[model samples]
Target: MKKKLLNQPTFLLGTIITSIMLLMTFIGFFYTPYDPTQMDNSNKLAGCSLEHIMGCDNFGRDIFSRVLQGMGNTFLIAVATVTIGVVCGILLGAFTGYFGGWIDEVIMRIIDVIFAFPSILLALVFVSIFGTGKYNVVFALGIAFIPSFARIVRSEFIKYKDMDYVKSARLAGVSDLRIMFVHILPNTMTVLLSSIMIGFNNAVLSEAGMSYLGIGVQPPDASLGSMLSEAQSYLFSAPNYAIFPGVMIILLVLGFSLMADGLKSR
Candidate 1:
């Protein structure tokens, strides 16, 4: 399995990219060349120099520092969003699928209604209603993700629950919870992992979009989306301002997407 995974170019490349991004994020939480928020009036929009690896923004803040910080924020939000979605999704899907009946019908109906709208759109509405901030974005996107995760887990559960091995386990007095989680869940990891990668990618883009609309991360804090939003006005004056964040977003999304592709290929 290890050798096969390593043999995949998509997995190798995606692993490299995401590993680098993760390293940058981990480092950004500790050290940076300049305060991401620090502004130097005379140094505003300065071109890249040894002292400012990526140059300075309109506010004279180090674009490198802000870029690092933006990556951190985006990653943090994605992690939080996936955490919520996975926990809730797994539970809901496990229960509904293992014990099917009116309860399954009711829950599935509710899921259908939620699925009618895009997760980000649902998140957008939630952010609009709850007011904008990082946690709010996490919450909105997290809940919006539940339906998809649940559906995936549910399908897997339904398929695995009736297998001869499951019947033997049931006859042997294994708890339903154990059967669902211990025996069946691991089998679903192949598909679930791919979905997780896609979910992380979606979270990044959704957060970026919400922040671009100026309703997501807010000022003083740097986020890729918010940085992209801030960079828009300076496109002509400082094209690199937009370019840097745009590139990071692309890399981030691409890394996860490629990772998903690789996982699916396996």
Candidate 2:
């Protein structure tokens, strides 16, 4: 059954695309065809050639190298944001759901308030206050994402907290923490995993949007969003500047979406 599900076209394609991007990100840590940050005005806006496969940006930085480096930056921010959201969100949600009292009401109300604002707007506010940087972007996006993850985890915990195994664990004199973390949490893994993938996809997109708006990773650090923002003016003359990064962002998001769908199907 597992093998059959893995063989499904959506799952296979997602895995392949995600693996390629992951490989690119890993390789980018050690090497790129040229220095991604180095500028060469003499070769600025050059088209694809044997020397520079993805061509050059207006600043003459190798687009291929920049894209490779940007992959690492983008993935790093997404992973960090998702990690923060999952850890903090799950703990808060599980406690609220399992306890279910004034505590739950208070927490849910706070979450509701957060949800009242669109995520991008919240992110913009955070960036504006905290100032623009890579870590700031991660922090902003992670905080903005907390409400959704918390809601999902809270629902999952509510469903599983009353299950037989959980009750048995409680009757066995197990601590509430133990029941929540050990007994209840494992049962929620399917939903949690699905939420995690979706959160990661959203994180990536949010970071890109923030960066494009000039509130994300700043200059000299290549990010897919910043790359697109920079290439906008050069759209007509150096279309590859916009094209490569734009395609990369699409592929990244598509890979995660397909993976989430595949997992949910199982």
Candidate 3:
């Protein structure tokens, strides 16, 4: 498997990008060139130099440091939201697909309603009700993500639930749980894994959108979206401020997208 992945250029590139971003985020936990939030009026708006690698923000904080922190925060939120979607979605989809009765009808109807709405729009609604915070963003996006995951998982399960191996297991007196999870779920991993990468991409974008709107992560905290939002006013004076974070977001989305494509193709 590792050898196969090495031969896939798309997968190799995606893995490299994702791995670098994760490593940078991890490093932010223990070290940074400067305090990400520290204000230095004297150094504010200064261009990149030996002292400040990416230069100073309007408040004179280290842009590079904040970026590292922002990367970590954005990644954490994405993971949390995706995890919620995956766990809930798998359970709902698996059971409904395997059983296929009145319960499937009712649950699927609800998922359909959610699926009809735009994920960002539904997330906006939940954020409004729950109020603004990292956790709230996670909750809103997580809920919004459930429908897509459930729909995918359900289709996969329905397709495989009655396969020959599943029937053999059933005849062996295997419990329904074992049949679904042990026998069938493994068969769905390739598709599920591909979807998971796509899900992470969506989560990253959604969180950035929320933060850009001033309702996510909040001020004094660094998020790529919030940073871009805050830097808009200085577009001419400090174009790099926006450019740096914008690039990070692009790299992030591109990395996951490539990964998903690679997984699907492989």
Candidate 4:
């Protein structure tokens, strides 16, 4: 069943959307209709036409250009958040799982405490205290996701630690680091890859949520979240404004989710 789903055209469409968004990220760096941060008072609220494919925003800025630029900003935030979370999770989980003692107890307890609150709520708290900005948003999102990565990696480590190769590595006087990396880490990678993919998707959504609340990337910086927030006010007259960014987010998330599921099944 999973194989059939993997083979389907919808999955291909998701893949294509994700690929195109990434392509736009790099392509947008060198080209855009106008600087996304620049405002044109005269062009404000211009409707879709030959001059503006997606139309102009309330500020008369090009919606299509902003969306393109926003994709780049969004990609960077997602990559940073996920990279930090996954790396921290892997190291902490390895230490806790491989050495299982007071170390494991303390780490797990801390993870449990962090998990007690809803992630977005926790992030909101951080954002509120730090004030809204790009770094704050990234930090809030990264920290919010740490516990899940830690827990997942810890579980993977626990499963692989008892395997014969690990036991042999220990007996052979392989350094603990060597055993963890040379033996355990590689074995746990399948699960980790899937976790990272899901983490990437979550990072995208989390950033959007923060932006919607005015805590994410500031205005003038294009991001799907900020774009959606701006479009909400014009949904009646410029439905395409909301629709395009919304679909981009959905497709990006769906692609990663599907790829994660496929890897897990294998």
Candidate 5:
């Protein structure tokens, strides 16, 4: 059943689409048809043509080039956010789980408090406080996700703390750090990887959302969210403007989701 599910068409498509997008992102770093940020006001809003594929945006920047570059920025933000959330979460969870008592209660309470608010709202609040930019957006998104990752790690720790291996390590006078990382962490990797994948997808979406709302990565840097936001105003006439970035976002999200599911099933 698991193998069949992993081999499904949707899964394959997700994988392929994600790979291609990622490839484009790397390729974009070195070469593209034109500068993604360049504005040619004279040629603004041109339709797809031999010279300008994917049309020109309102500012006359090549949509294709901008989209590719935007994907790259999106990837950067997602990676940073996930890394921050995961590392901090794991450390906090391990401490709270292994030590228990007041430590666990304090950590769990913090997680509860953060989780009380919707993540998006929390992100918005952070972004507003910090001011808008790529770094600020990543920081906001990362902070928003810490509670989830911490909670998951705490659960894993609670589940495995009393196993025979842990007991043996404890009796052998293994350092708490060693026991946590060497004995416990390895067991948690499967769940951690799945959680990180979920985090990745959420980070991308959240960053895109903030950008669309004009509170995220600034102009001069093409972001899928920013593009979509701009496209919204011209929906009736330039439906393609919104459609392309929207599809890319969906593809990326679906890709992470499928890969996460595959890992969990394994």
Candidate 6:
């Protein structure tokens, strides 16, 4: 099963793309052709050349460097957001599903209330209230994404709570915590893993949208969304400024989407 999964076409393709993006992000820590934020008015809007492989933006900052740096920021926010969502969702879902009765009803009702608002809208509200920054955006998106993961996890836990293995663990004097964490959690992960990937994709998109709207990672730090936002004015004059960042966003989302699909197929 593991070998087949590793060999799956979609999985392999997604892995390759994701790996390349990660490599670019890692490389940004050490080197880029030029400083992404350094502006050289003399070279403004220059076309791709040996010196500037991806060309220069209107501010004359190297597009390649900005894109690489943006990749790192996007990855960080998305990973952090998904981590918060998954952890909180799993804990709440496990407790509610295992305990059942009033606890389930109350927790699920709360989740439903959160679900009433669209994720983006909810995130926007959070950003508006907490103000803007990378961590703020992560927190906002993480809270917004919790309901979806909670519902998925709740269903999975409910499905397994009464299963033979779980019952066996219960009968064998295993504590509820142990059964839920040690046994049920592992089984639930197969499905949860796919959801996690999808959530990560959504998180990246959400962060980009928030940043584009001016509530995400602020200036001095680059993000694909912020780059696109800044380049909007120079679209006709220097299309490469927007083009590279747009492509990076699409590729990043595509990689996660494909990986989710592959994991689901497993």
What TM-scores do the predictions have? 0.97, 0.97, 0.98, 0.92, 0.93, 0.97
For candidate 1, give the lDDT of residue 44: 88
Q: Which candidate number has the best TM-score?
A: 3
lDDT of 1 by residue, 21-139 (tens): 88998999999989999999988888878998788899999999999999999899999999899999999999999999999999999988998998778877897799989999999
Q: 73, model 3: CA deviation in Å?
A: 0.7
lDDT of 4 at 19: 80
lDDT of 1: 0.91
The per-model lDDT (C-alpha) reads 0.91, 0.89, 0.91, 0.84, 0.86, 0.89
Candidate 6 segments exceeding 4 Å error: none
RMSD (CA, Å), each prediction: 1.1, 1.1, 0.9, 2.7, 2.3, 1.1
Scored against the true structure, residue 28 in model 5 reaches a CA lDDT of: 77
Quote the positional error of residue 5 for candidate 1 in Å. 0.4
* Model 4 TM-score on a 0 to 1 scale: 0.92
Please list the residue runs of candidate 5 whose C-alpha ends up more than 4 Å from where it truly belongs after superposition. Answer: 1-13
Per-residue alpha-carbon lDDT of candidate 4 for residues 24-65, written as tens digits (9 for 90 to 100): 778888899777767789988778788778878888888888
Clashing pairs in 6: none
lDDT of 2: 0.89
Q: Write the per-residue lDDT of candidate 5 for residues 1-266, one digit (tens) a residue.
A: 65675587665666777788789889877788999888999878888788887888888889888888888888899999999899889999989988899978977898899889987788889877878888988888888889999989988998888999999999999998999989999999889988898899999998898898898879978899999999998887777678778888888888888877777766
Q: Can you list the residue pairs that collide in candidate 3?
A: none
* Model 2, residue 62: C-alpha shift (Å): 0.3
Candidate 4 runs further than 4 Å off? 1-14
- Candidate 3 regions off by >4 Å? none
Count the clashes in each prediction. Answer: 0, 0, 0, 3, 0, 0
State the lDDT of candidate 3 residue by residue for 214-249, as single tens digits: 888987989998999999999999888998889999
Task: Say what the RMSD of model 3 is.
Answer: 0.9
